[model samples]
Target chain A: MDEPEVEAMDEPEVEAMDEPEVEAPGAPGAPGAPGRGVRERRLHPVTPLRRAWAPVAVGAGWAVHDPDGAYRQVTDLALWTLLLAGGGLVVAAALYGFLSWWFTHFAVTDTELRIRTGLLFRRTAHIRLDRLQAVDVNQPLLARVAGVAKLKMDVIGTDSKDELAYLSEKDAAALRAELLARAAGFAPETAQDVGEAPVANLVHVPPRQLAVSLLLTGSTWVLLVAALAVPPVLWLTTHSPGLVIGTGLPLLGAAGASSVGKFVKEYDWRVGESPDGLRLDHGLLDKEHETVPPGRVQTVRIVEPLLWRRRGWVRVELDVAGSSNSVLVPVAPRELAVEVIARILPGVTVPEAEALSRPPERSKWCVPVWWRGHGLAVTDAVFATRHGLLGRTLALVPHAKVQSVRLTQGPWERRNGVADVHVETGANTTVAARLRDAAEAELLLQAQADRSRTGRRTARPDRWMAQ
Target chain B: MTQQPGDRYGTEGSAAAADAPPGETASPEPVWRSLPRSMLTLRRLLLVVWMVPLAVAAGLLLGLLAGPAWAAFAALPLALLLWGWPLLGRNWRSWRYAERADDLLIQRGVLWREETIVPYGRMQLVEVESGPLQRKFGLASLQLHTAAAATDATIPGLDPREAERLRDRLTELGEARSAGL
Candidate 1:
């Protein structure tokens, strides 16, 4: 498999790029070749191995069920059943896979990527180039072995995700690069320039740091401390070894396993600067490469656990348009988290006291749980909400992304002369530093609501070229 | 109507007092429009007509299968008719919607009050639908779907003509506001 050396693209140009011209299948001049006059006509084919294996694997499972003689099945009879049933299933699956592969066709046009599949009930899904959000290339163990990869495109304003499964590894990479380049509105010659764009490695979570971060995050440390305190207390009170072992061992085991799970899931976490927005690549078994375009992120949360607060470590998480929650920085120093926030969202950052805006001190008494942990800072482009005692969170939501603003006063909050202001974005909503002064919350709600409307009205299409 | 002494805002069981501060609560009491008064009667009748047969069949099946001990569930229909009648009326009475310049507020619930404000600009799709029963009564529901899944708001039991007007107005506003995106 060959990796295509392609450059990053400009955001606005990506949006401005019109629907590309569809090439006839088998044209000589392919997308990769700049000077060739022949239109690229070859539609990449998908590997049929996945579909071939599906039914065979199910049949094999059935054949293997109750293999032990204790289950009253003769070994010879079972083997015969396995051979007949598994063989039949394999043949059936192979035919199905071949038919599917024969019928499925994918084409990358100037403006859109079209994928047509289904032997009888034909379905064709087209993904517009300008609306392309991310191009993910997936290679499972089998696909990698077969030298094939799957290309998935996430487009804006559509539910039908476009997938071109089982392309040759080289072709997949080329297609991904080509699509990204096209989205960025790059001509063939200029596309090479994007490849040279400096990729700033913001922070790479090391094994040691990841372990420390996991330990300090959420209830892992608390559970450990409690586990330590529990045996002593249980031993003194119950004087029963059975109960102690029954409860203590499982708790410790569960906690240890969970810590490892979290570490493994986020193994080799890396954050880097891409052409459009920021790219996050992580995971151990199934590697995930996510490209979060600018303005796609509706809400950004910076969390600092109780222990991590002292160490000045925080986790930066983002909620994009389609996805629920994604971690920008799983765990990093506060400075790095803040730096990432400022970089990703230029106009919005952790409010540092200076000439422009000071942290809201008037609403300090509203948050009774932990006043010090709660703060609200508003800027022209975004509003930042800071809250949490155990795990401190700093949520930065752009005014343009805000769908609505709500000022809620419950019986308890009203009694305390405090209220909560909620700012809702596309997918997620962030409360204004928890409970704030009722009067101030109301004012903030109105101001933020107006800001949201104004921001949407005046927001630029793309900030890349504008900046 | 003067508000109850214990209330902060004009909530359930609390009379709507004339005077209130600007920032203390939402402004101007949001000239609220309640659901059709007949919706309560329609809902109550539907509940009784639907539940009586269902409850009797379930009770009979249980009596035949696992003895009469389980047949006690049949009392559910009678209980529903007795309490559900008033509960439906209260719920129908509580359902109120107010349209502001920028946002639409829908308030419902008797004990646990819930107020949802769906900004007109944020609305992606507006649908006016009527079920068979509702259509028979010339009533329709106006559903507003926003980007946020949780923000999907529905106003039920509006006149069909009114629903159509609201839908057109909302769709127009949504398209106008979303043009910038």
Candidate 2:
């Protein structure tokens, strides 16, 4: 057997068999076929969708959007009551149809995974087994209640629109395992041991921390709750219970929703090695777990938001090649960042132990080797220099990994003699880090970009002292 | 109207247009060849200006029939607003993919006219696509997916028949490159 090429794992993206990338002299006939190496391309006759409530669900949803108007036309109480019952049935039937279609419409063949959809006129798309890169399983609110889940397979040919379904958790898991095995660079491994709750507890948060986390966010919901603040203040002065309750009710509801969301969204957030690759699972309404390999990672960015900075925390994101552009692990206690670098890189040189023992500068542009008691020797960071409260931000795109660099100076930035540099890295993972440099940082950026460990020592700059 | 950048030279890719460095070719396919005349849809320019306003006018006529003066009046501005999007599409670009011996060259970008060279050795996949319009025009665009993080070089625009021939060459080159790696 050919010795495996990539270290740790041999990761090759397996996009589903999309429209055949027919490359022969003619569009038909395989260049080499009648054998195993030649993948067979077949459009399966779609399995009849159990559509057996999608229309009902869609109709019910439409009715829900305009509730009273639906029955308001019926002045007769008895007639209105009958109409309401029929409406409810329609709604239930639609939900049932949606569930059935979502669950059973997907099929996994030996060489391809096929999804046949569209209500009136069916459309069938087959993604080749070898083309698949990764599979991401998401559980919406309905999925949890019904013990169903949605699985999305990332394949090379994008002609395949996203395939969504509401499959039984057991079936979804089995399908996921099976597809992962067939996908190139993926082999069936023991599934992750996610608990019943499979949620993160946000253990470090203190009591009354809602004031710190939620209120501080000033999210739209918080603003909605705050909008009622004035009326309550007036009512409290007048001592009118009706006015107070009316305004207070929404505030209570908003606060409850925000707190619960904050607590639930970050629950059981785990990022670690999976059999095929890295799996990150988080969120509530829709629980998402994504698997990606290092080869597919185009850019890796480590950021410290102001609040997280105050807590001495950081967030890591990967511009994944297979999935959506951004994959964020929202909370990390600095060490994990280093562990990530050490465990998941090619040639990373950890800054000297003594180098990390230095003090942090007040300016946000630079990350300190040490902040408070914490050590910071990260090669990648997006912090203060590009941070903003409401308006614009200046990101610090590191020089080493930039595929191509775009430097822009607006009239205002030009006036100030400042320029924003966007360093695009990797096609899929366009992780760009920008810094505020008038002219001095150019040498540093260029130096980092050209710094390659594998290159000959003779290729080094004339100023090379490390050798 | 939004005051967009009038024009600038530094932002243009005039300098990056120089021929690639020596010994860079990694595949055996030729990058440049003739293509069909039907690649660009001049008719799209008409729809780009016409369709949206027609729909808005139709909606406005209905509103006027329903007796809403304000809604009828809203049609003029709304139709203009709807039609404006496609007209201001200064950034939309066209591309061409050429398969040459040892490399796949992509010519793209509107004002900048940037051409990228992806030696077959560096490319991992060759993707070809033809949207509805491209199909009508008998043209296809090919994107070259590479393992490199910074940029996945792409070459698009080919006559349908030429696209198929080049696609085979690119695939062969990509396989050979991976094998060598």
Candidate 3:
């Protein structure tokens, strides 16, 4: 294994030489500089152990699934032989992991970041620095224990394969800063210390508030009601308490596990405003640091759950193109949510008491219950729509970010003279005004197209640093 | 003017007039172009190819398992094919695409009316695809992709030459008005 791994490590060096290398002139860290320029690095030495742990645990789980059969099979083998076989398996897995780790290498040049990995089928990704969208540092529980983190970079129009795992936590932070600085078009020596930049702390969610919010979620209540109602009903019908236990235990366990997972994932959520963008830091076992550049934010959503409404709490989430939907504020006061939105999207305000156009009275026949909550507001800068009955969702999409507009009507809607207009964005967050007057829907469709045309004309340039 | 079946759905002249804003002068009616009639034939041919095999298998199985009377089950696929014959035509006729000043309009569906307006500037990619059968039928499909995945608009069953022309025009417009997502 070691012999083959050493041979594979030499292959990327030969391949790298075949590609044209455009070294930046007067770059403080040029290709030849020992400490500064184009230094190719490998992941931490503990990567093999970390990589092998997952598959080993999965194998253990399968063995435990049928304990009796596993015991009989083990007993059939001599003790010494069984021990030898288990040791061999462990050695084989470790060798495989080590070989993979040995073959992987990454380097950051002036213009691009290059990652080369894979054993048999080598895959190389060249991510241009100018196209970088955001940088993130994530530390899972095991990696956290090992004092290592993963550096992930989001590039425009690319699916995520731009990740380097098992770098020392400190090294990950430094590398992230360096990459961000380079992406912002600063020389390596002149790059400012991003860590020292003043961050105005916006919102820090209390543990108590987070716990309460998780419990107040719609799924939790539904599960609670089912857990309370199903067992008793089953007992009355079947007269067997055993069947009730079998059915009720799994339901309770699932609900508890799901709630606990969410709680741990969102523990100690904090949002801050910095020059780079909105900084989000959260996680209990796995720490995550993410930055959302204001320019990348495509849409914003403020959600008011039926239960949280009375408490005047709302969850804020935003869509940043090239990345997944991220929670800006998991749970915060309405004012705090608004403030966060305003920071992410400058010059835009969340309408509080504005009278938005509601679907016509006759359209109510289609959506009897939700008709009242449905509303659409078209502003110069943003298009806002509100809907939902038990939980209200207010989606705000900037006209500049609108990708397209659509008008749809079903057979039922046609008879009711109602239609739905969808305002689409590059991200998952869409502003859909449901069940509006048919003529109004058509007008909205055309008007939104016009607005988006003008919006794109005056929109900011894609390169944030250039501006 | 004699009312065409499509006029009942308000897909043409009157719909465009109604779509204009209150104060704006009514813009010239967009020239709505329909898909080729050969597309209906292509669809019917494919339907027959798929249904014929299933009908034969059903007839043989029923005849072997039960009795000759149950062999009538083979008629189910035939019935579906016959029913879909005219339905496919309506669906084909329902497909219309118009390239406007700054955006492309695609109106489709029979029971559920859907109109997609994809701005030229927002288009990220455009593709022209043709299967072996479609090639034999002299047909190609033009697909418009935007930054938003939801903006899925495809104009199928166009003359191959027309598809290429449209693709080139759209790509040129897209690049000229390209607004980075």
Model 2 CA deviation exceeding 4 Å by range? A1-68, A76-105, A109-111, A129-133, A156-161, A184-259, A284-286, A322-327, A344-404, A407-420, A425-467, B1-181
- Colliding residue pairs in candidate 3: none
* Candidate that scores best on lDDT: 3
TM-score, every prediction: 0.71, 0.51, 0.83
Q: CAPRI verdict on model 1?
A: incorrect
True-structure RMSD, every candidate: 9.9, 14.0, 8.7
Error in Å for residue B161 of model 2: 18
TM-score of 3: 0.83
lDDT of 2 at A301: 54
- For model 1, residues A1-467, the per-residue Cα lDDT tens digits are 00111113322222222335534443332232322232332334445666787886774576587456424654446787868865887788888987777666665555567666676676766666655556566666667667777767765454433567768877776677666665665664454334423457877999789888787666776667767878878999999999888878877876776687678768898888866557776766555556665556778888777777777888888877654237788888888888888888766657642322222454454554476566666666677777665676778888787876666666555666666667777754554545667666655655565566656655545323222
- Alpha-carbon lDDT of model 3: 0.78
Candidate order by decreasing lDDT? 3, 1, 2
For model 3, report DockQ.
0.31
Output the worst ten-in-a-row residue range by lDDT, candidate 2 chain A.
A458-467
lDDT of 3 by residue, A1-467 (tens): 11232234223221132234423322332233223335566787888886677667876887799888878888999989989988887888898799878767777765567776776766778786655667778889988888999888777655645688879988887887777665665544455354434678999999999999998888876776787889999999998989999989988876776688778989999898876667889999989988765477888889999999999999998887776537879899999899888878877878764557778888778888679898877666788889887888898998889999999999999999999999889874567999988887887787677667657766654444443
